[model samples]
Target: MSTATVNPAGGTSPAPAADACCTPSQGEAILNAGQAEALALRFKALGDPNRLRILSIVSASESAETCVCDLPEPLGLKQPTVSHHLKILVEAGILHREKRGVWAYYSVVPGALESLGASLAAKP
Candidate 1:
């Protein structure tokens, strides 16, 4: 059954029932809460320019990794500031950190960026 409503011309038209508006559409894929939270953390880490720059520098390094001590000069940031960004990236699972004697080195996690891109391109 439908309800009647006045149109712009002042004639009555049958309007859809209220329940019809609440029906869930089929075949739509949606992220669950946990997935959304995880993605948000990763995206949030990438939100900062410094963090993105850190990813770029590390990815372009000869060994596909970079030493913590080597970041400050190129980034124009202090050691502590660069370190802070690196920590966020590591926590977000976008980068991996390895401690080698006196310095920590960072590299991008395998397939992490690809997974993120795939999530956006996913179909129902």
Candidate 2:
């Protein structure tokens, strides 16, 4: 995908495609070699089904976050196992963590998700 830098301050530079609209709010920061690796690592973490389910369940709650005890029984996994998935998500920058005593909370990182979407939508 082609990368075009967008200023985070204000205003949007045109994307490579002339007809493209919905310019990103944060000016495009084209992913370089290193940035691409970082992004790929994030996607790799998401390739797991368990991780995806945890994220979905957490996202479905009234709060944008989830606690260790909140997962459903259908996952059929222990808390430590579930927390392992959460750790990968957290490392991937796709999740935000809140520690309340021994209860660790997790939430989606919208900017990372949006950036991933934008990169995919960009020209190849």
TM-score of each: 0.74, 0.66
Per-residue lDDT tens digits for candidate 2, residues 1-124, read 4544554565455464544455444645566798778778988987989888887787787365688787646588987798788889889888899998988788887787778778778832
For residues 1-124, what per-residue lDDT tens digits would candidate 1 score against the true structure? 5444333575333454564444333344777788789888988998999888888888897365799988899889998899899999999899999998897889999899888878778831
Residues forming the 10-long window of minimal summed lDDT in candidate 2:
16-25
114 Cα displacement, candidate 1 (Å): 1.0
lDDT of each: 0.81, 0.76
- The segments of candidate 1 whose C-alpha lies over 4 angstroms from its true place after superposition are 1-29, 62-64
lDDT of 1: 0.81
- For candidate 1, give the lDDT of residue 115: 88
Sum up the clashes in candidate 1. Answer: 0
